[model samples]
Target: DAGVTQSPTHLIKTRGQQVTLRCSPISGHKSVSWYQQVLGQGPQFIFQYYEKEERGRGNFPDRFSARQFPNYSSELNVNALLLGDSALYLCASRATGTNEKLFFGSGTQLSVL
Candidate 1:
């Protein structure tokens, strides 16, 4: 069994560009969620997808969106990035229909210049 995994451990971009982050959930998991952690702040939920549908969302702007594939992999997209968007984009997953503990990947560190 493999834990969750994310691509591009680190990323650098200038303001106003768009970026996409990827995530692959652990085996047998059906729910994937996206979170953003700014410097010195706890992770804040961005979006959650379960069974290929949006399950939950946080207080984020329309620029933030995500979707879970049938294979349980997920991608988070951010458009018109702002300096405030620079943060550790963490991807988490849990078993379906249960509040089980989430498995978090190291995350893609996005740095907006």
Candidate 2:
């Protein structure tokens, strides 16, 4: 069985542009969450979806959004990217909700110029 995976290990973009990052959850997992980690900072939750329905969300701006698919994959979309948006976008998945152990992918490192 494969663990969580993310695409485009690194990304570079300019301000005012948009970017989309992808994630695939572990087998048999139905919940996928998106997080952002700034340089030297801890990961902050962005959004979480379970069974294709949004289960939880964090203190993120409208520019950040995500959705889970029926196959348990997910995508994180950021609109109107800013230089401050440069960070590592991490994807985490859990077999179940509440206190479940989360598995994370290395993440897509986004750089805004």
State TM-scores per candidate: 0.96, 0.95
Superposed Cα RMSD, model 1: 0.9
lDDT against the true structure, per candidate, is: 0.93, 0.93
TM-score of 2: 0.95
Tens-digit lDDT string for candidate 2 (1-113): 88999998999999999999999999988889999999999999999899999888899899998888879999999999999999999999998755878999999999999
Stretches of model 1 off by over 4 angstroms after superposition:
none
lDDT per residue for candidate 1 within 21-92, as digits (tens), equals: 999999998989999999999999999898999988999999998888889999999999999999999999
lDDT of 1: 0.93
Candidate 2 Cα deviation (angstroms), residue 22:
0.3
**What does the lDDT read for residue 66 in candidate 2?**
86
The true-versus-predicted C-alpha distance at residue 74 of model 1, in Å, is: 0.3
Q: List the residue pairs that clash in candidate 1.
A: none
